[model samples]
Target: MEESLPEALSTERIDGYVDLRSYGAIGDGRTVALIALDGAIDWMPVPSLGSIPVFARLLDGEDGGAIELAPSDPFTVTRRYLPGSNVLETTFTTATGRARITDALVTGVAGRLPWLELARRVDGLEGSVHFRWRVAPGTRFARSSPWVEQTTHGKVIRIDGVTIAVKGSDHGPRGGGPRGLQGSFTTSAESRHLLIVAGTADEPLHLPDAASTDRTIDRTIQNWQLWSSEFSYDGPWADAVQRSALALKLLIYSPTGSIAAAATTSLPESMSGGKNWDYRYAWVRDLAYTVNALIRFGLREETHAAVSWLLTTIKEHGPELHIFYTLDGDTPPEVELLDAPGWRGVGPVAIGNPAKSQLQLGIYGDLFVTMRRYVEAGNLLDAETGRLLASVADRASDAWRQRDSGMWELEELRHYTSSKMGCWMALDSAVALCELGQIPGNSERWKSERDAIRDWIEKHCWSEKRQAWVAWPGAEELDASVLLHAPSGFDRGKRMSTTIDALREELGRGPLLYRYTGAEREEGTFVACAFWMASALACVGRQEEATELLDGLVALGNDVGLYSEMMDADDHSFLGNLPQGLSHLALITAAITIEELSR
Candidate 1:
C-alpha cells in the first residue's frame, strides 16, 4: 500500500469548489446527497426536504460541511451509477493502485426507511490502495455547528434536532471512532470495506447490526433495479429515459407523495444574487410535469399517489392556490437570506422562495393536466375533487384577464402569452374531463371560455413582427416556454413549425436552448427548454432534427444521467438544484414524442 501523496492528491484542497457536473447523486426518497467525483458528499438535506443541510459544501465551500473519502495518493477519478440505480460508483486510479467507491443513501427493510442512511463501500480493484476519509460537518450553512459526541456505534453529530451517527469500515480495524471519524486504511485486491452514516431526529437512532446494514444496501439496489424494470419506454433514448425516470423517483417524498422541484437549496440559477433560490419544495407546475412523466413510464402507483396528494392539498386551499407548497401541503416559511457565501461567492443565499406568493396563473392548468392524466389512467375523481376542478376552471376563466406574474415568476405583471395559454389549457382539459364524465362541470361555460381564450391569444399573443407567438402580447422577445404549446395542443400546424424555427434562430445555443432570448448571455441554457424544443421539433414533423436535438440534450446530463435546473452555456456545468424534476420530465416527454414519431 502506498503511503506517499501523489502531486495532485497532495495539492487538491479538500475545500475547493468542484464543477457541479463532476458530481453524481444518491437519494432514499426523503432526501438526496451530491457526491463529487472525488468521493465527497457535498450537499444533502437530512430528515426531510427543506431541512437544514448537514453537508452543504456545494454552497458554503470551506465553511459548509462535507463527508469525503478518497485515495491518499493522487488519482484520476471516473464515476458512474450502478446500472438502473442511484448507487454511485467512483473509481480512482493512481500510479500504484486502483480502487472503487460506491455511495448510496439506502432505504430500509420496509421499502421506505424511517431514517436517513448513507452506505459507502470500497473495493480494491488492483494492486494496493490507501484511502482516507473524514466526516467534517461544517457549521450548518454558517448558522451553527453540530454538537458531536462519541457513541457506541461510532460518532454522533447533532444539528437542529437531527442525530447522525458515523460508523467506520467494518472490513478493516477501525482507527477513529466518534471523534472526527478520520483515518487512512489500506486495501488489497479482493478486499472490501463498508462505512455507514445513519441519521434520525424524531425517533431514536436505529443502528442495525453490521451484517443487517450491509444487507439493507443490497436490498436497496435490488429495489431500484426492480423499479427500473417496470419502466415501459423502450424508445429512441431508452437509457436516458430510464435514468430520468429514476431521477424523478428520487424527488418523490414517499410519506406524503409530494415530488420536490429539485434536491438542493441556494444553488444559483445564474452566477450571482437574486438568481439564487431554494428549490427543495414542490411546485405545482413541476409536480404536474412529474406526474405526467411518471404516468408515461407506467408508474401508476406513484403518479396516482402524487396526484391524490396534490388534489387534496388544492381542495383544502381552493379558489386561490399558490405556485408551490411544502411536502405536507403547508405554506413555506418566509425567505431567509442565510449569512453564508454562496457558490462561487454568490451572496444572498436564500432559503425559502418568495415565488410562493406570486400569482403564476399557470397553477390552474398545471393541476388540470395532472387531473386529466389521473383520469386517463383509470383513476376516479371523487365528487369533492370534481367540484374543486370546476371551481379551478371557473377561476381560470375569470383570472386569465388579470395581470399576474407569468410562468417565469417575473416581478413585473403582464399579459404573458404563455400564462394565457395555460389558462386556456386549464379550461381545455377541464372540458375534456367533463365531457368524458370523469368530473362534474358546466362543460358549456368551460368550452365557451376556452374558445374565447384561444381567440384572445390568437388576436393579441401573436407577434406579426417576429411572426411567432411571443412571450407577451405585442412583445417581440420570445421565450422557450412557448414550445410547451405543442404538447399542450395550443398549436400543431405550420405556425408552430415557424414558431420553432423562430425560437431556434433567437435563443438556440447549438443543441442547448436558453429559457428566453437573453438567457444564454445572462444565465445558462435551461435543461427543460432544450427538451421542450426537441418535442416541439418532433411535433412539427422534424423527426430527424428533433432526434438530433434530443440526443444532444441527453448528452448534457451528468455522467450518471442526472440534470440540474440549468446548464452553464460556456462550460456546460450544471447550475441550480440537481435532479431537477422539470428537466427530467421534459427529457422523458421528448423521448416519448420521438418514439411516437418513429412509430
Candidate 2:
C-alpha cells in the first residue's frame, strides 16, 4: 500500500545563482530540459525548442514551474551522464541512506515521441531514504496560468491547451495517490520507483503503465548509445570531442533537421543581466558550424540532413537567406519582452531575436563553406541547389564591399574585418567548387572579388599600433572572430601569428576569450572564440601553445562535458544558454586541427 500527502512541498534554493554548471541536460531531439543537482527540472520548453518554457525556474525562481525530486532530509548530491550518452544519473547521499535518480527524455524507435515525456527512475542504494516529489505547473513564460483538471486519465495540469499527466509507482505518506500527483515516498535498499511526466499540445495525455516506461528508459539509453557509436573521431581530446558531438546532437530538431543555436533563452550573458537573449532559433551560421563538426566526425547522416534542409529552405524562401529562421523554415516571430523578471533579476526578458533583420555578411561564407564540405564528403548537389549556390556566390561578390553586422550581430554597422573576410571566403569557396564542377558559376567574378577583398582587408583592417587586424577598417579594437579566418586559407603566416598574439593580449582571459575588445564586461568570455584562437594558434605553428590552450578550454566545461555560450569571467560559472552549438563546433574544430597537426 502507498501513502499520499499535500500538493505543496517545501524547497530550499541552493546557494547563490545555482551555478549553471551544476545542471545536467537531457533532450529527445525536439525539446530539452535542464535538471539541477538538487533533482529539480529548472528549465524546459514544451512542444518544441522555440516554444515558451513550461518550467522557467532556471530563470524565474520559486514562482516559476518545476518538477522536483529530492530527499526530505539534508543531502549532498553528485551527478554525471551515462558514458557516451546524454542520459543523466544523479546520486544523493543523506545521513541515513542514499539513492540514485536516472533521468531522460524518453524516445521511441522512430525518434522523439510525438508527445513530451520526461522519465525519472529512482533506485535505493542503501538504508531507508525518504524522498519528496512535486509537479508544479506554471504559466508559459508567466503569460497564463495552469489549472488542475480531473480527467478520465486521472488528475492532470492543463496549460495552453496542453495536458500534463504525471504517473508514478509510489504515492504519499497517506494511502492512495495524491490528488495532484504530488507527495512523499520512502524507499528501502531493495526498492525501485518510476515516475513520468508526459504531455501533448492537444492529444489526450495518458498515464503510461510503469512497467512499459521502465522498458522505455532502457531503450532510450540504447538509442543514444547507438547514435553515439556511429560517430568516429579518433582525434586528440577524443573524449571531449565525443562529448561535444553528443552535446551538439541535443541541439538538432530531429523532426525538421534544423539545429538550434542553444537549448535555452534569457540566461544572462553578463552578470548585470541586460545582455540576456533568446538563442533557441536556428541560425544559418550555427547550422553551418554544426555541419562542419558533424562532417569532421565522419557522421554523414546528420550533415546531409542539415544541408538538404538548408537547400530546401532557401529554395522556398528565395535565394537570399535570412540570418536565422524557425526550425520549421519560417521567419521567426517579432522579438517580445516577457513580463517576468529575467534570470537573477535581469529585466527585459525577451522571447524572439531581432537578428533576423540584420544583414550578417558572414552567413554567405558560412553557407557556402558548409555546402563545399557537403559536396567534398561525396554527397551530390542537386541541380536546383547548384543554381542556388551560384546565385549566392554572385550575391557575395556584390556584397563583399558593403558594411554590415559581422558574426557577433552587434548593432553598429561598419566595414567589419570579419564580414569582409567572410565574403572573401564565400567567393573563394565558390571558385573552388566551380573548379570542381560542383557549381556552374563564372569563376572570373568570384576570383576578382576575392582578390579585391584580400587587398582591401590587408590595407584597411591592419593596425600598426595593435600589429593585427582590428574588428573593422580604421579601428584599433580587436575581434576574436578574425582568428577563425586563419584556417579559411586567407593567411596562415606571420601576420596571422601577430593577429593571434594581439587577440590574446587584448581579448583573451587565459584560455577563454571575449567576442571583441570591450571593457563593459557585460558578458563572460565567448566560448567559441577561445577554441577558434586555439585552432588559429595551431595554424600559425604555435602547436605547443595551441595544445595547452585547447586543454584548458576543454577543462572549463561542466562535469558532463557540456558548455554554454559564455562563462562568468569572475568565477568561471557558465552563462547564457546551455549546450551551445557554436561552442561544441569550436571544440570539434580545434580537436580536428590538433589531430591533423599531430600527424
Candidate 3:
C-alpha cells in the first residue's frame, strides 16, 4: 500500500499496466499507495485517492516515475506489521548489517493536522547498514516532463506541465553527489535515518504546505489507534483481520468517505495488455462490502459515513445509474491512454474506465442490499434517501431485460443470468422496504416480478449438463458469477450447492478460485470471488469448510497484509492491482459473516 509505494518511482507506471506486487499497502484514507517486496513505490495519487496520478510508475519504468529506497548491500529481507496497527516494518540484513525500516501514512491522530504523508524511517537495529534512495517524479501518468532541481533537502522533482512538486526526504544538503550522498552509518546500538517522500497537488487540493506535509506522525498513529480502540474483534486471526480492516480504511477517500476500487488502477487483471481498467473510482458493490466489514468491526463512523456518501450519490444522480463513479460522484470517467511503455512490456497503459459506459445491471443489487443492511441495523435512512431507493427499484425493473455489458464487461452482450438475478434482488429489497414501511412501493407487484425474474433465470441460465448456472442464457461456460446465488439469496437450496460443487471442481485454482475457465487471458484469482465462495459456503451450512477456505484466502495477503487483484498461482506472487478494494471488501465480508455465524 502507501507504505511501499514511494511518492517517486517508475512503479507508478508499472502499477498502471499490471500491479504492485507482494509487499505492503499504506494509506491515510484520502490517498492509498502500493509498496512492493523489492522496495519499490509503484503508485500514489496525490491530493486524494481518485485524483490523477502524480506517481504512476507501476505502469512504466523510469518514464512513469517512483520513489525507491533499497539496501545498499546484498541483503535478505523479512517484514511484518506493527503489533496493533497496519504500519509495516521491513528488516534487511546485508553484509554491512541489519536495518529495520518502518513505513506509515500520516493520519489525523491527536495533534496532527490533516495531510497525507509516507514515512520510511530507517533504524539500524544490529550492525551497520547502508541504503540508497531516490525521488523520481514523472509526468501526469508520466506523460508530463518535469525538471529535477537540487533543493535544500536532497532533490525536488517537479512536473511543470502538470505543476506537481514531488519532494524528497531529509537526507542532506542539496547537490551532494549523483549517488545522492551515501554514508555508512554505524549502529553498534542505535542509529536512525528517516526519509519522507511526499506528493502534493495544491492546485487540485488547495491545501497549504503546513497542511500538505503536516507533521502529526505521532498524532496520526494515535488517531488510528483511538479509532481502532472500539473494535470488538478478537479471534485466532484477529490481528490479521484488524490489519486488513485498517488497510481498507486507508483506501477510503476521507473527504467523501468513498472507497476507490483499488489503491492502484490500470493494473492489468491479465498480464498481457487489453485487460487494464482504471479502478480509481468507487463501485457501489465494492463500497457496500467495505461498509459491511467496517460495521462488523464496530467502526460505525466509517460505515455510516460511507453509506451516507453512497446514498447521497444515488440521490443526487437520479434515474440513470452508473456502475462506477468518482469519489465526488462524477459521471462515467474520461478514458485516455497515456503515452508510456507498459509494465513488463504489456502495452497501452490506459486511464479512465470504459466500463463506465457499459450498463452493469448488477449495481442495483449492491445498492439495495447495502441500503437494506443499514436499515436492518436500525440506522435511519433519511426521507429523501427512502424515496430515492423506491424510484431506483422502479426504474431497475424496466432495465432488467436489457443486455448489459455484464459483470465481466465483455463486449459481447447476452442475457447474463447473474445480472438478471441482480435485478431480482433489487425488487426483493424493494419488497422488503415496503414491508418495513420505509417507502411506498407495490410490495405484491415487486414480489411477483422478482419471482418471475427468478423463474426466467432458472429456465434459461442453469445448465443441465454442467449442473451449474452458465454465464448467460445460452452459454455453456460455467461462470463463477453464478456462485453468487446463495449469497445474493437467488437460489440456496440444491441448485446452489450443485453450482458451488461444480465451481470448486472446475474453477478452483490451486488454493483459491478463479472467475471462469480458460480465461488465462483473465489470469489471477478473484480475491472477492474467493470470499464469495466462503460466504456461499457459510450460508449453505458448510461452516467448517467455509472457515478453512477463508483462512487460506487471508493468508494470501502479503507479509505486511496487502492483497492484489490476482495471485500468481504458480509462484504465489501477488498479481494484478495491489491493495484492491474488492479483495479487502471480500476479506471484510467473509470475516463478518463468519464471525456472525459463529456467534
Candidate 4:
C-alpha cells in the first residue's frame, strides 16, 4: 500500500429518514462515495478515505454538505449494489416512470492505485422524469469554501485548504460543468444520460465523453465480475458471501493492504448520544481475520497484501505494536473533534483515533493468525517478518502481563480474561512457528508461558456462580471477546459454551450481540458482536442457531448491502461507521464457516 485510502461520506440521520428513496456506495481503494436513491450524494470525501467530506449532508442534512442529482419531483426509489461489487445503482421510479443512477469510485484494475476517483452516471431508464442536481462543496470537515470555476473540460473546485482540484462533469445537465448546474430535463425509456465525474484528484481530471463514459461503465462491470469470479464456494448464502467478500475488499486500503474497521464514523450507534468513535483506521486484530476471509475466497493476492501491510507496520515500529493504524500503516492518527455541529446535534464528531497509544498485546494473536496462514500455504516467512514475530514474542513475554485496553478498547484496564488468552495465543502460535521452522524462538519458554496464561485464565477468569468465564479477574460481567477465545485456541470445552449462553442471555440486545452492556456506554449495538455471535454459535455446534443468526445478520445490510460499525436495536438504523470491515469480515467468516459446518 502506497498512500492513504480516501473516503467520501458518512451516514447521518435526518429529522426523519422516511423520505429517503434509496442509497448506494461506490469506491476506488482510496475513497468511497455514497449515493442516495434520490440521485444525491449525501456524502463524499476527497483524495484519501480519511479526508474530510466535501459533501456530508448524510450526517447533518444540507447544513452538513451534499451533491444532489435527482428528480425535482416526488418519486419512490429502489437500490442495490451491482452483484459482487461495490458499484451501486439506484433507480427512482416517479409518476412518469424510472430514472437509473450508477455510482462507483474508480479504482484501477485489481485496485492497485493510490489516488481515488468516484464516477456517477444517471442514465434514463424508462419514461421522462424531471431531473435536478447540485454539487455543493464543504471545506475542512465541511467548514471551508473551496473555489469552484467552470472549465471547458468540466468544472474544477479548488480547495484553498487543499491544493487539489475537485472536478465535476458536464454529463449531468446541459449547462452543468461544475459551476453548480441546475435545470429541468426529461428522458424517455431509451434515452440514456450521464453524470460522469465528481471528485478531487491530483492530476488533470477528465470527464468521460459519451463514448468514454460508456466504456468506463462497461469496464467497471467487467472489473467486478472478474474480481468476484474467483469465489468457487457455492452454498445457501453464496450470494450474500460474495457480496460480503466484495464489501470487505472495498474496505481494504490497497496501498497498505490494511482493512479499516469501518468506512464512515460517528453515526449514532444508539442514537445521537450512544458513543460514536471514528472507525477509519485498521485494527491489527481485524486484518488478521480479514486475511483469512480473503484467502477463503481464493483471494491470495489480497491476503498477501494485508500480511505485507501488517508486517511493514510492525517492522517499522518494533518496540511496541498499536491496536490500530491508518490504512497506509502510518503512525497512530491524532484524534480531534470537528469545529462544526455534529450529526443531529451529536456533539464532538471525531476525526482520528486516540486509542493508538494504548498497549494491545492481543494484536499479536491476530497477526500470527494471519501469518500462520501464509506458512500453511507453503509461503516462506521473510527474515524480517520472522524476526519481527520472534521479537513480538519476546516483547509479549514482558508486556502481556501489563493491563491495557482489551478488544473493546474500554478505559479501565484490568486483567481481561480474553487479553490473557490472547497472550496464550501469541505463545501458542510462536510454538507452532518453531515446529514449522518458520522462525526460531524460545519455544520451550513460549510453551511454558502459554500454559501459565491459560491456567491463570481458567482459574481466575471463571465465574462458578454465573457458569461462564467472565470479563476479567474479579469482574462479574460477561465479555463478548471471551467468545473469541476458542477460535483463538484459549478454551473450547463446556466452559466456552457456558460463556456463549451466558452472553446471549445477558448481552443479547436482540438477535445481535452487544460488545458489552456499558462498553459503548451510549453507543449503538455493535454489528461485529452479531458476527461474533454467529461464530460462537458455529463453534458450539449450534449449527441451526448459527445459521439463523447469520441469516438475520444479512438483513442488516442497507438496500445496497453496506454495513455501519453498529446498528440501532430499536429502529434497526445503521449506527457507528458505515461499510465496516469487521462487520463484513464477520459476514464472510460466518458464511464460510456455515458452509463448512454444513458440509
Candidate 5:
C-alpha cells in the first residue's frame, strides 16, 4: 500500500504561483520539468535544459505554458517519488473519489531518447473521479508563438522549429486557440489512462503509441531503481542522501556529461527580484563538489564521465578556464532578459548567465581538486590532461596575487580570502598529483607558491578582532566559503574550528547561514553553505555538533527531499532555483564526512 504524505504538504497556490517548496522535478538527462503539487508542469525547457522553455508558467503565470492536470473539483493531495526513482506518484482525493497520477520524463531502452517525452499515467484508485487536463505550450517565453495544426497523426502543436504531439485523451481534442489542447474525462475504479507529450526540434516529431509509452514509463522507473541501487551509501540521513543523489542525477546532462548548477534559470534568490540569475550552466566549483561527492558514494560511471567532460572541454577551450560552461561544454552566451512577469511579480527573468565571463579565481582550485580526487580514487590521468593541469597550476601560482571575483562572482575585484585559499588548494593538489606520478609539473614552484599563499592568507586574511578568517584582507566581513577548506584538508586546527563558531554566530539564522556578511540584506541564506558548515564541523572533530546540525538541515528540504538554492531564514520558504545541484552535493558530502568521522 502506498503511504500518504503528511498533512503539512498543502496544494494551495498564492496569487497564481505555487510556492517553490511545492515543486517536484522529472527529467530525461537532457531536460527537466518542474511539476507543482497542484499537478501543473509550470517550468520545462524543451530539447535541453538550457534551451528556451515551452512551459513557463512558473515565471509568467497563465501566459507561460503549462500542462495542467488534476481533479475538476476540490481535492486534497498526497504524493511521493516512486521508491528509489525520480518517477513521481501524486494521489488526489476529491469529494467524490480518488485518482493517482504517475509522472516521468520517460527514458528509452538504450538510455535517453533522441526526442523529448513526458508521460503521465492516471490510475483510478476508488470510486468515480472527474479529471481535467490541458496541454498548453507557452510562447517559448515570448520568443516563438505556438500554433495547432491537423495532421494525419491528429492535432500537433508547432512552435518555431519544434513540433509537439499529445496522446491518449477522451473527448474532442479541443483547441485553446494558439495556446494548445484540453480535455475532460471521468474514471471508474481500476481504470487506467496514459498521456504522453512528445516533442522534437529541428527534426521530425515522433508520435508515441499509448501502449508503448505506458510500458516505457515502467521501464524508466526500473532504470532509475537500478541506478539508485548501485549507489553505495549507508550513512545517517541515508534516505535524504539517496534522494539528493537522484536529484543530482537529473541535473547531470548525459549528452556531454556536464552537470547543471540547477535545473531552472532565473528562479529568484530573493522575492524582490534583481538577485535572479540563470543557473542552467555548469559551474566548475559546483562540479568539483559534485565529483567529490560522487566519488564518495562509489558511483564511478558518473564521476568518470564528469571528469572526462571537464578535461576535454578545458583542453579544447583553455588554457584559461571560464567559471562555468554550457551543458554542451561551450562558454555560455550573454544574458537576455525576458518580458515575462517573473515568479510572484519578480521581474527580469533571465536566460544566459553573466557570471560566465567573471574572473572567479577559485575555479583553479575546483579543477585541480576534482582531478586529485579522481586520481586518488585509482583512476589514471592521461598525459595530455596531466599537462593541462600542470599549466593551470603555473597560472594559479601568479593569479593568486591578483584581485578578482572570488567564488561568489562579485563584480568588485578584491583579494578574497577564499579565492586565495582556492589558489593555495590548487597548487597543493598539483604538488600531490606530481608526487603520485599523475601529472608532470614544476612541483618545486607549486610547493613554493602553495606556502607563499598560505603565508599571505595567514598574515592578511585572518581577523584577530573577530577571531575568524575575514572575507578578504583587512575586511571585517565573514564568508561561509572559507569553511570549504576544512574539507579540502587546508586546516583542521584551532583557526578553522574557531572560524566555524564565528560564522554561525555572525551569519547563521538557525540551521541556515548567509553566504557572507551583508548577504542577508540582499538575499536568503544559501542552502549549500549550511551543509558546508556541517561538513566543516565534522572535519574539525565536532561530530555531535555536526550531527545535530545535519539533522536540522536535512529536515528543511521539501517533502520529497528536494532543495532549492536558498531558503528564507525567517519564513523557511524556498528561494532561488529548484533541485539545486550544489545543495544536494553538499548534503551528500556532509553526510559521508559525518559517517566517516563517526567510524
Candidate 6:
C-alpha cells in the first residue's frame, strides 16, 4: 500500500524554462518528448511529431501544461539511458531515502503501438520516499482550451478532437477540472508503482491496464536493445557513435519512414530570439547524411527505408525538388506564429518552415549522393527511381547557372560556392551512375556540365587573399559548408587543405565552428559544421588533427550524449532544437571517416 506525500516538490523553472542540457528524450518512433532532469515532461506532441503538442510547458511555461513527477523532499538527481536503449533511468536521492524512476514512450509486442502511450515506473530503493505527480495536458499552444470530463469510462482531458487519459495510482484532488489530474503517493522499500498516460486523436483511446503497460515498457526496452545490437561499428568513439545512432532513430517518422531534422521546433539558435524556426520537417541534405551514416554502420533496414522514402517523396512532387518535405511526404504549410510565450519568453513560437520554397541547389548533390550510396550498398533502384534521378541531374545542370539560395537558405540569392560544388557533385554522380548502367542518362552531357562546374569554381570561387574558397565569388567571407566537399571527393588538394586552416582561423571557437563568417553575430556555432571540419580534415590527410578535433567535439554533448542544432560559444549551452539529426548524423559520419582512414 502507498502512503500520502507530506508536501509538494517543485521543479524550478528559471524564467519558465529548463536548461536544454538538463533534458533527455523518449519516443515511440512516431513522436518524442523531452523530460527535464527534475522529472517533468515539458514537451510532447501527440498524434505525431509534427502535430500540436499536448504538453508545451517547454514553450509556454505552466500555462502550456506538463506531466510532473518528483520526490516530495529536497533531492539530488542522477540519470542515464539504460544500456543500449532509449529508456531513461533517473535516480533521486532525498535526505531520508532513495527512489528510481524509469520512463519511456512505449513500443508494442510487435513494434510501435497503434496509439501513443507514455509509461513511468517508480521503485523505492531504500527507506520511504514520497512522490508528487501531475498529468496536465496543455492548451495545444493556446489553440484550444482543455478540461476534464467524466465519462462512463473514467476521467479524461479533452481538447478539440484529442482525448488524453491518465491511469494508475490515484490521490490528491478527486476531480481535476481544468488544472488536470494530480496525485501523491509514498513508496516504501521494495515497492513498485506505475503510471501510464495514453492518448488518441479522433479515435477511441486504448487504455492498457497497469500490468500490460508495465510489460510494454519492458518490451520497449528490449526492442530498442535488439535494434541497437543489429548494427556493428567497432570504431573509435564507438560509444558516442552508437548513442548518436540511437538519437537519430528517435527522429525517424515510423509511418512514412522519413526523418525529421530535430525532435523539437523553435527552441532558438540564440537566446535573444528571432532565429527560431520549426525543424520538424525532413530535409534532403540531412537525410543524405543520415543515409550515409546508417550505410557505414551496416544498418540496412533504416537506410533502405530512408532512401525509399526520399526517392518516393521526390518522385511524387519533383522534377524540381524542394529543400524539405513534411513528415508525411508533402509540402509544409505556411509558417504560423503561435500565441504561446516561447521558451524563456523567446517569442514567436512557430510551426512549419519557410525554407520549403527556397531554391537550394545543394539538394541536387544531396539526392544524387544518396542514390549513389544506396546503389553502392548493393541496393537496387526501381526503374522509375532511376529515371527520376536522370531528370534531377538534367535539372541540376540547367539550374547550376542560376543564382539561388545556397545551403544556408539566405534570402539574398548569390552564386554560393557550396551550391556550385553541389551541382558539380550531382553531375559527376549522374555520369558515374550512367556508366554503371544504374541510371539512364546522357553521360556526355553530364560529364561536360560537371567539368564546367569545376572550371567555374576554380576560376571564381577561390579567393587567394583569404586563402580559402570564399562563400561566393567577389565575397571574402569563409563558409564551413565548403568543408563537406572534401569528403565528397570534389576537392582534397592543397586548395582544400589551405581552406580548412582558413576556416578554422576565422570560424573556429574552441572546437566548435560557426556556419559562416557572420553567423556568430546572429546565432550560435552550428554543430554539424564542427563535425564536417573533422571529416574534412580526415579526408585531406590530416587524420591526427581530425581525431583530436573530433575528441573535443565529442566531449561537447550533454551527459546523455545528445546534441542540439547549435551550441553557444560563450556559455557552451545548447541553442536551437534538441537531438538535431544533422548534428548526430555528422558525428556518426565523422567517426566512420576517421575509422576508415586509420586503416
**Which numbered prediction scores highest in TM-score against the true structure?**
5
Whole-model Cα lDDT of every candidate shown, in order? 0.81, 0.83, 0.70, 0.70, 0.90, 0.88
The parts of candidate 6 lying over 4 Å away from their true place are 1-11, 169-175
Tens digits of lDDT, candidate 1, 411-433: 88999888988998999999999
- TM-score of each candidate structure, all chains considered together: 0.95, 0.95, 0.89, 0.91, 0.98, 0.97
Worst 10 residues of 6 by lDDT: 1-10
Instruction: Single out the weakest 10-residue window by summed lDDT for candidate 1.
Output: 1-10
Model 4 residue 412 lDDT? 80
lDDT tens string, model 5, 1-599?
45455455677876668888889999999999999998999988888999888888989885788998899999988889998999999999988899999999999989999999999999998998998889988887788888898898689888988888889844446656755988878878999888788999899988888889889999999999999999889878999999999999999999988999999878888877898888999889889989988898889999999999999999889888998999999988888998888898887799888787788789999999999999999999999988888888899999989998888888899999999999999999999999999899559999999999999999999988888999999999999999999988888888999999999999999999999999999999999999999999999999999999999999899877899999999978899998999899999989999999889
Evaluated with lDDT, which candidate comes out highest?
Answer: 5
Assess candidate 3 and give its TM-score to the true structure: 0.89
**Winner of 3 and 6 under lDDT:** 6
- Per-residue lDDT of model 4, residues 364-440, tens digit only: 78877778877887678987678878887877777778897888777788878788888888788888987899987
**What tens digits encode model 3's per-residue C-alpha lDDT throughout 197-248?**
5555544321223333335454565667776787887764676678777777
lDDT (0-100) at residue 288 of candidate 6?
92
Error of 5 at 248 (Å): 0.4
**Shift in Å, residue 151, candidate 2:** 1.5
lDDT string for model 2 (381-453, tens) is 8777788899989988888878898888888899999999998898888998999888885799899999999
> Each model's number of backbone clashes?
1, 4, 42, 26, 0, 1
For residue 1, what is the lDDT in candidate 4?
11
- Decide which is better by lDDT, 2 or 3: 2
Task: Judging by TM-score, tell me the better candidate of 1 and 6.
Answer: 6
Clashing pairs in 5: none
RMSD of 5: 1.3
